[model samples]
Target: MNPVLSSSEVGVKINEWYKMIRQFSVPDAEILKAEVEQEIQRMEEDEYLLIYFSLMKFRHQLMLDYLEPVTTRIRPTIDELLEKIETSNKGISGLLSYYSLFFRGMYEFDKKQYMKAIYYYREAEKQLIHVPDEIERAEFHFKLAEAYYGMKQSHVSMHHVKQALDIYNQYELYKVRKVQCMFVISGNYIDFKRYEKSQPHLEKALELSRELNNKRLISSALYNLGTNFADSGDYEQAEVFMKQAVEITEKEKLTNLPHSLFSYAKILFKQGKMNEAIQVSKKGLSAALYQGDELFAKLQGYLKALYVDAVDQHGVNQTIEYLEKNKNYSYVEDIACETAAAYANSKEFETSYVYHQKMVETQTQIQRGECLYDF
Candidate 1:
């Protein structure tokens, strides 16, 4: 414990460190870890400082966990932070409530619980009125946009992203965040199949990301541009951009490696490079399986399509079995449709008819929004 410093003084020091973490300016990771441990120890003697320290640590850890490929290691810290926030008094609680809610939203977002994230984010929004910091508000909106995007609510995602952009544009220091907002807007346009609208945003994001010398941002911009072109039937342009994105993802060991590879393989398939597409899709499936459940599902869809086109009924059967075992209803219709077509080609009318019926039923449930699976 620091005998010379009062609780308020300790809070001030914690706040300074918190700002540094938020601004992505922490100088040395090892040193910062040591300092954080020391501060946490001191918190044993000061309740006020404990609240501030816990909030700041939670913020820092949340950001780190978001960047990590797996989050199991950080779960204990997150739970402890939530407990600390819940037990605090009104005065200290008032100061930390928005951050607590925001972190909870991020935690859920990272876990791929998009609807739960949206709920926590909405709760945070109610506390925003008391928090007068424009930059913080912009950050909150950006996070909300991400949650909406994860839920495939593209219009709502665009709305929140635009709000974040409006605020970020007012501050020169927030140029990076503004560029990220542009990327999100571009993605939303792509989701809506508004390729023409997505082009300028991707171009701007690419230019800004290059200028900032940010490999991840540059790769993401290129990937989005590739997806936009592919969706618009521009196979040549899609192949060029997607290959660049895949190269960057591979060299940088980025989490988007599987996604980029899948996109590139899709372009190859569109360009009639059957052998290359199948090979690349197989590699992407391996990578996606290691990455996470979401990426794995996406790769399964790609591989299923590739198998259907290649006339590899065995491959299709294997993928369908996996999907069925996992109860992945979102892709059930597509898988059934493909299986039906494959059987029809083989002149197996009875089996084809069975799968065709399954396809129709799944499609109807999807149209009625009664399916449990979501991408």
Candidate 2:
């Protein structure tokens, strides 16, 4: 409660605040954040501390953004912070430099720029020597795992997640991180087409989320479980889990409500519930549009076109073009293959050949470094 503190004391407080933010201790972090901000002004003479405070502030904002992504204020401030840190004339310490790269990777990750995120994360990994704390190293590994997983590098992701999980499992204060590690591990297994192997991790994640009373994690677990089931051709079971996920996300106004709805629509469609699928897709599209989620909006738009009366070939082509322009080769490849199979089933050999060609080209692009593992 002292209004004035020495530089070392302030450093201690800031480090404590960083821990709180990483743990998702919202209320405690907010209180400590204000305290640190106040104390920081009194020590403006310490340039290193100032840079450290700025970095932590950026990270705190990221934690807040994760909770309310639609209301994020990270864009302008992130660039400004990066500029300030890079332009500072004072010699940067090793730890400060490491944080600069690491946090920027997190910013890119938040934007869904997986390749860029991995680039920064890899650069930061080189500075791991500057970060002495074992737990901080675990944090870095966890972030790298997420970026790799996002880019579909399952083996690399599994490696990093296991590293992070090993450390996180040792700390009782890191239950949230443990849950996240479980999700990443499960997701990697799902991507490897080992659905049965993925289930136990998800089940454990679900159990831990419920014990923590964290709705966000609970909904995520349910949604991932639904996806696993859907991919395994168990639409009925997928529907049960996805519906619960949608209900929780919609009621709680979670950021992933649109994503849950999107998955639910696919599940319904796979089960031959055409009418319900159309309705759910429409709802997802509306949610994505409202949230200004251009990626999901475009995806839902394509699905809507496919679901409407006759297959809108032109619309499908236009959306595929958009996805390709955005470097979403995986999505384009998936859609193109599906379109090709559908046309083949309908005996439209010419159209099916065109789509098959498109799929092949996208796969080639994926293999040629135009996409996938771009780093």
Candidate 3:
């Protein structure tokens, strides 16, 4: 068929190739892919459309093959896109919108809010409709999978991710995101405790993260690889990644360094070193409070538990006070509350009876929030 087409024809062919790529007829598809490239080359263009076509059309298969060592160059792509996307301008374009959503969504996923990240991905997917590009569509699907996987929905996430991989293999769009999807798939396996299943994905993610020189992705992939070892009780290997996480944070001055510290704390706790566990928990909480408010709260809960176990009543009281001040604590979350209840339990029977009655009233208020509002 016709490989080199005019501007209008190029648009038509992009959508056509996307459909063909999805259908998995690789040999027939490549002929058109080559033609599309030839046409893109012939045009006296200065826009990113051809490169976009190169990625969005084929998706990134051979592009993966050609990746040079990742360097500071890729960092500006992130920054420039971020600036344009602070508000919707025509210059950002539909294609770039897809990429921006992906970049930001991955950041959100790392932050552990799967729902909000998925919302960004949906926005990305919506913008993709205007471009009608195949490789980009596949990538969008893959990112959606990543978001879903972050939500702990593995099966559906796996299906979409494979669709991205299949299309990349077929059309040869092998950019960094393609590599990212591979790592994310491994993460799904890790989540399911299939450590053997995750090795290949982690291996590739590490390789590509280096090639991309993407510090954020490199640290993330390393963390996941280390997590697999940790999960299998391979503390030694876990230590390796946990160390990498720390190194990255120190170098980048990145605030989200709690995961590594917390992992280290758990390992110490398991070893029966209560002192080390308390120390690590405090360190993690210190960074987490300013860096990660949502997660810091949970880490503080653990810190409080450690205090109680260590028989530090004053420390436990302080932790409870902090949690209450934050308004992010649960009364039944830890033994501390039960311990307080026990203290009340040991008091005079009449005092215990009064406390028990307050519990009933509190339960009633909780069950009828609207009634409280009504009164």
Clash count for each candidate, listed in order shown: 0, 0, 11
Highest lDDT: which candidate? 2
Model 1 spans > 4 angstroms off: 26-36, 47-52, 65-95, 292-294, 305-375
TM-score, every prediction: 0.75, 0.90, 0.53
Put down candidate 2 lDDT per residue, 1-375, tens digits, no spaces: 446567999999999999998898888999999999888877647777888888899899888766644544443466788788778744675788899889999988876677778888888877899998889999999999998877667788899999999999898988889989998998889878899999999999999999989888899999999988987888899999999999988877777877788889978876779998999998999898887677788888777666664568988888898887767676788789878887888899999999999999987775563443434
Q: Evaluate residue 294 in candidate 1 and report its C-alpha lDDT on the 0 to 100 scale.
A: 61
Backbone clashes in model 1, listed as residue pairs: none
Runs with alpha carbons beyond 4 Å of true place in candidate 2? 1-4, 68-76, 90-93, 360-375
Tens digit per residue, CA lDDT, model 1, 218-317: 8988998998998788999998999898888777766667767877886887687878887777778877777664636555564655453554556556
Model 2: what TM-score?
0.90
lDDT of each: 0.71, 0.84, 0.60
Residue 374, candidate 2: alpha-carbon lDDT = 38
Model 3 spans with C-alpha error above 4 angstroms: 1-111, 119-128, 168-175, 303-375
Worst 10 residues of 3 by lDDT: 64-73
TM-score ranking from best candidate downward: 2, 1, 3
What is the alpha-carbon lDDT of model 3 when measured against the actual structure? 0.60
Residue 281 miss distance in model 2 (angstroms): 2.0
